[model samples]
Target chain A: MAPRIDTPGAAAQAVDQIQQLRTRISRLQESTPPSMPLETHPALAGLVQLRAGAAYSVDSATLALALLAGPSRSGGWCAAVGVADFGAEAAAALGVDLGRTVLVPDPGDQWLEVTAALVDVAAVVLVRTTGRVAPQAAEKLAARLRKRGAALVAWGEWPRCEVRLTTREPSWRGVGQGDGHLSSRRLVVEAHRGSAPPRRGALWLPGEDQTYRPERAVPVAAPVEGVA
Target chain B: MVVWCPDWPVVAALADEGLPSHLPAAVFHANLVQSGNAAARSFGVRRGMRRRDAQSRCPELKVYRATPERDSRTFETVLAAVEEQHPGVAPLRPGLAALRSPRRVRGGETAAAALLAERLVELGVWDPRLGVADELFTAEQAARQASSQDCRVIAPGESVPFLRELPVESIDDAADGGDAVSLLRRLGLRTLGELADLPAAAVRDRFGPRVAWVHRVVGGAGAVPLSTRTPPPELARHVDFEPPLDNAETITFSARQTADRVVAGLAAQQLVCTEVRIDAYVEGSDDVVSSRHWLHPRWFTAADLVDRLHWQLQGGFKAGEVRAPVSRVLFTPVTVVPDAVHADGLWGGTDERVQRGIARVQGMLGHEAVVQPVLQGGRAPRERQALVPWGEKPTGLRPAAHPWPGSIPPPAPSRVLATPWPAEVVGTGGRPVSVDARGAVLGEPARFRPEPGDWMPVAAWAGPWPVEELWWEPGGRRVARFQVVGVDGRAWLMTWESPGTWWTEAAYD
Candidate 1:
């Protein structure tokens, strides 16, 4: 029984927040920790350092895909923000506990609820908004997410939430064992934070039978000893 | 007359299908609380049938008032008593029950049957019957005869005598007025035991060989074995708070403690609830104030459950007012599935991986808070979105980006600019912001500059897009908005010359 924070006319409420409102958020960043960058879990390290009382936003699907690749427990603690029901297919695909994942009904103040929910969830998968939010609502919600140690991710457009990740549709080529269907897909992604250069790699969806495998770092050319 | 349980497992499955709980005398339910009309229709009550429908189904079709608590209590008791006797009871329905036992024992099963009958009577069941048969099919039939406080024991070999006397109608009633009875009646078979009197060949010749089998069953002949099942776990305890708790705090505390106990029970088996239902009622308010607490699958913590109670009792819910002090509290796991997760493998597999993933969410969004829009039922696009429990998955993942062709186009701001700001849009670049005959205006306007902001010089912008909405009403399509981006690194979708001035449309995010 959460406090029923009815964001009455949240769209209208947030509409007032249009762009003038400013937001102050302390970010949770993934650092190398003076050790091996390879051994470091960037997503996890960054997640734990998140400030508890702030509000922020991120990409929902991207976060989920990243989580699927990284270490995580099941019971679907991750939440997708939207008014519609995301069933077993998506939950299973995301590899979270289907039971634990929640669907927030679409209330007018999607921004406000997204903001409010930010404080409670580790990550909020916002179905990228097609409609515009009141600038103030966006600021207040972002401010709140920053304080709450929660993260908001916009699924379609990353910058809208001020945070983002990039993953393109994977192309697969293979038939899966189940029902003789093709399950292979190939995907390429480049994840970047703030202004960091994107971490690039190829992802292979091994026909549903095998787990997703990411290719190792694409090497950057280092100038040879004598070469200018 | 199969009344749907509606306990998550039941209610969510009604897919524009026919109602199951209907037949008057048997269990009928359009919903858990009983759809008497649905029941009436089945009992010869047709469409447009009224109260007279009740009598048509079955005069004695006992309308057992349903309270989820009562159904649960009855189920618990039924399961308990069945387990107590044979140590093997598999639950069937909320208000109904079943138990399994082995057959063909060197020592006759009569002893087991007698023991079960005695226990059922002792456990507050009215009249109990003990049945001993090689087949479960016969055992169920034997129990049917034992319903009237009379101990009717149908031994394995003596089923002929036991079933021969019972009318075909009895078998139909026992099956909740389902199939077998009607099929048998159509074949002209009057009693269960009469099959024993018929010749196998003759029975088969008339009923396509299936009759021979029925004849054998009716004659109580053949060696049928039983498939025994394990009994359900028994974890019941009673507690009476000394001072009746009349306030929400007291009730919440009790609920919290109760939640601990519930969690402990599940944890012992390494399980967590996908759903937990909390039943709370005031001590003296038994007649009026009783509330049911529904938690989303994400509300797994003790705090979560307690918070749910606090929110409900302190206010007026659909169930009405919390008028009385709730003296008793019943916490049941409406659903407790298991959580079998493999540990993280070489690649940060399990929990660690999850934390990282969550961190990414929190890092960007700013916090760990997650919620969902819960309320639906709206006609407007903005009105349709409702915030619900965080961590919940979205039902419909609507495509996030779309080009509003007829209206102001994007590369628009992700945010809807605030309105009623008291502004003036003095320039429209000589393109009157009006809807044309073909509903098309040549590139509405390429740009604009705000009052407070510096004048926009460069024009790397697009659109004087025209939009008309709700054309039915006079002046319905109120604002003819446009998309304008200034060369000064700023972009906006502003409604030029509307009810008020310069209402900024959107930002590029």
Candidate 2:
């Protein structure tokens, strides 16, 4: 039998101990990564939640940069592997901290090793594979990523990913036939997860003000069909 | 004591050109004679004479460009020779050096000077002169008065008298004393004795600080004590292979100890090396077969140095198949700073874990393969970004804040192609779209092929934003940029070169 003291200090101490135990128990469960509030771009906030120890794939370079900018803006280190055509100015303009970004433009045949090594340090890593990665290599990298509690954003197809983001129905706002320059773009971003219906949202990839934000309630017109 | 080798620039230049010392040679800078050798001086060539005038005076004068670096590099041997005789040698210039008079030598100051002269003569400095006196200024003047390979000794108490008898023009040797020397000459003070007789305060008020200081020194107030330079410690280390190791792995494995020694030596002095020069000497070569300078973002440790050695060896040899067996490998610390500059902050700096991880990756790929992205100002997307290799500082980057007039507007392209892809754009009648020399659009682009065969109709388009870059120089380009959006919703940055060639520079995916 436990003896409880009728004191305010004892009651508070008991509460603290219970909270500590709960956290410990949560940590002990290794099946899934504990969800933490990862800083996501406001334009992608409600559509999908970025969790630690997960792999996310994006079809467009802008979306990859957006995902990377979330962790980088919050003062986390980021790395890009095998992305020879990474546009640094665009990344910086989109709020990615260039100072904390390490880039391996061409990893040659060692892309997997390089990405795995970077995962141990950087909060988020974006990789562009030269060819389709083997299943075993992907599985191995996933385990390492979970253990290190870092996220991976693949620029191309991956064997298995927690979320897959693709940009569709893109339209330029201020461009016309030999007139004004490209000012902004409106794109519909779809996030697909396993067995669940994909989440769709409309956003200005870069609004005319150079800030990314969700589009208003106005419906976008159908894309103009092109001659194939 | 002062050791003076006159006309050092001309001497060093002639030696570098492999010309005989007896030939008339003059070192010129900005078309004016900076220094002339004795042979040129005898032919009426003087410092500050125009190149044409000097050539006219002596048709055979060998005019070589003046390089302070060459002069100093040649003087290093002379300095080392003097330092071998006496430890505290202060180099005043390329040709002049000062040292404390060695009064304790067997033949006193004169004998010590003679000993140094003999050493300089061995180094091909045929006319090295030495002087001993009570102060540095007097000693330097005395050295000038001394004959070739000789010594001039001004007895301790006789410095004042010795300086007084010198001409007022002698003051010009002091830095920024030219105007004062001229003023004194204009005032009819031909000898330093006349200048020294003036009241100290009057000279101080009239001739400025330099002349005032000279007056005080000439008035028998002793000059400041010599601030002797401490000799640099020997931090370079080398390892020699037994029987000349042909295998790269064996060479680096053996060099591990030398690398450790180099780092430890630096640590002993509470310093760290940021730049190191590694040289591998092949068995049959008199010079280094492979030499490269490796820079570290922070300071290097022993392990980093070994990795650099391994990489250097591997890079110099194709697939580790050495062309010539490596006999010796040397490690030289090119740049070192105190460890305090790199000490960890209270909350620690960049995560050491990240540094280690990046280093491991650098081991897998070459160092240049790992880079840090940086933004810079330019008109083109490719020019706006710079990739600095990992563990090296970015240099010569254009500032981004400056307004670039012809630059593309914001909403920069996402994927800046490493190399521009050749492309084709056609108008309504299958005519190739082009931009004329005056930046006029030849035809409205309707369909484009960004790749080899994939054609897409242009959904929206803008520009022929014309830019004439580096037009006055060779290889200059006259390009007109265009922003074209395809039906697939991908936008491309295309440039139309004169005479109808199109290239896709970047894509907004």
Candidate 3:
């Protein structure tokens, strides 16, 4: 037995039911504290996408500052914990709003407590630990970050991070044997997420023009034999 | 009724310096004498005399800088004493105050004035004078004429004739700039009687409005009413322990109620305190053993106050541990503003939840541990940045707008070492490189070691950029700086001193 020809009214009613069911499925997906947009530097747009309620581990201080600059420029508060050697001017130059930034230079034995407190308020928190973090402490902080909808950028090793960024093959320009000053630097940034193959991108982590952007390919010189 | 204390500035300055009142003293503002004591006046040092001339007149004179704050602060006690007798007292200036004529008191006006004078004597006012009249101007004039610790009462309707005989200089007290008095004297009007005798229209046309007003007052035609002042409400709170508490936790627990009361008191007044001064007194001591002023980015809550008390008792960075058991603790609001000024916007302002969170961390660590970074003008990376304790307003920062010459061109270092690490830079043949007196590099730096062991050849290097800072001061520094990049591609800012020592100051990581 087969169904007869459908009327216009029945077709519209079917579309409405399908729409309602789709919305319900989306709501169910959102029950796990849906991820929100976290600003990432334009130079790293394709290389990485920072999401709220996630922890990202970084190898260098400059990388941490670069990640902090994104949210800070968009008018969000940021904090740094146990970063005794924080370079405030450099952060400012990278577009981080110093007015909205706070620092706990030395938390001593209370680093975890201090970082957790700051995480409750700031949109992004950068932490530099003196020693390896315990797995239990990291898990506890991860849950808090998820609950608060804040992102974490660890300057050192962090357990089970969403993404790990490390700088490699750094080459500085604008200096000679003893003449010019140290100016710009070009580095290969490798982004690793879970077990996925690591993505590599070349960037002028501040090019000679004092802007962070993807490095353009240098035109290869014509072969000597072909030119002759 | 008006009460006047003569040479109050000199008196207050001497008392503050713990100097003898009988000794000659003068308060100077802008190098000119603002006030002089009796002893200084006897030495020919008068008001408006240059500080040099006053010093020459009396070699042993105690000189003090004029501070209006000191004068007003010391005068607060006197005002309180006067208010005890008469509630609505008007303070005219640092040295003068007025109140409504207390004519129908237990005793007449004279008896009331005598009682006030007696109270002033206890507060160490050597010469306090009082006067009573129907109007404020006349009362002030009469007070100046009264003898030490005495009252001059002008009978009703006798203000005109009583004021007529006084010198034109009497009007100098009313004219803040003293221009009218000088003009009156230059015009040969010697006394209030002569000035009063002149036609009102002519005084207005030639001598100006101020002189005309003086003329009207002297003729008893214009009588200005006094504006009495209301007493300020008490906002300070204190808690005393039955048995002195040595444990910080117990002391904080005891002070919880007082902290709540302090916040509730401000809330009742429709105000919020932004700065509070906390004083902790130890057992068997009258003076405060630990005193600190705590500031808040926003208004303080009761819990915030209690946290501050605990941190103070637990020994903050500047305030070391409380030496003895705490007997009492006091909280005084240093700065407050209307609550309406800080009302949250319709869309809300900076997150209040964030403030609470940061404050929680401040409670965990000491207050100084949380800091806000600020940039200021300087040559070195470390000097260019300042770390202000969280919640404190940054003050006395060097202006960054001014072009600081000799500062390294931007692409600033990423990591500025909190403490410079000892490094070594060697030239060819592994000899330490040094800078000459003229800032010339004696030999080119070839190899460098940022830490103790590992040595790497320099990939690129520049400078011996010399800086001579505060050369005239005893704690001056004279050093040459260099930017060196190692083979590993990590750049470091290094300093070279005279003794062939190299130190790494920062890293361009």
Best by TM-score: 2
Candidate 1 off by > 4 Å: A1-228, B1-81, B90-147, B154-156, B160-194, B197-202, B208-210, B218-220, B227-257, B278-280, B286-335, B342-396, B399-481, B495-505
For candidate 3, chain B by itself scores a TM value of 0.75
In candidate 2, what are the lDDT values of residues B1-45, reduced to their tens digit?
A: 999999998889877777778899999999999889999999999
- Indicate which candidate wins on lDDT: 2
lDDT of 3 at B135: 88
Tens-place lDDT digits, model 3, residues B1-509: 99999899998898787777899999999999989998999999988999899999999999899998999998999999999989999999998999999988878999999999999998888789998998888998899899989999999999999999999988775435288788789889899999999999998897777778879999888877778888998999999997898888899999999999999999999999999999999888899888898887777889889988888888832355576778999999999999998888898576778778888888788777889999998988999999998877787899998887778877889899889999999999988898887878888889999867889999999886788788899978778889999989888899886657789998898
Worst 10 residues of 2 chain B by lDDT: B314-323
Q: iRMSD per model? A: 16.0, 0.7, 0.9
> How displaced is residue A36 in candidate 1, in Å?
14
Q: Going through the candidates in order, what is chain B's TM-score? A: 0.56, 0.76, 0.75
On residues B252-314, what C-alpha lDDT tens digit does candidate 1 reach at each position? Answer: 777677767777777787766656655655554544355453644333555556655665555
Q: For candidate 3, give the DockQ.
A: 0.60
Give the better candidate number (2 or 3) by lDDT.
Answer: 2
Give the clashing pairs for model 2.
none
Q: What TM-score would candidate 2 get against the native?
A: 0.79
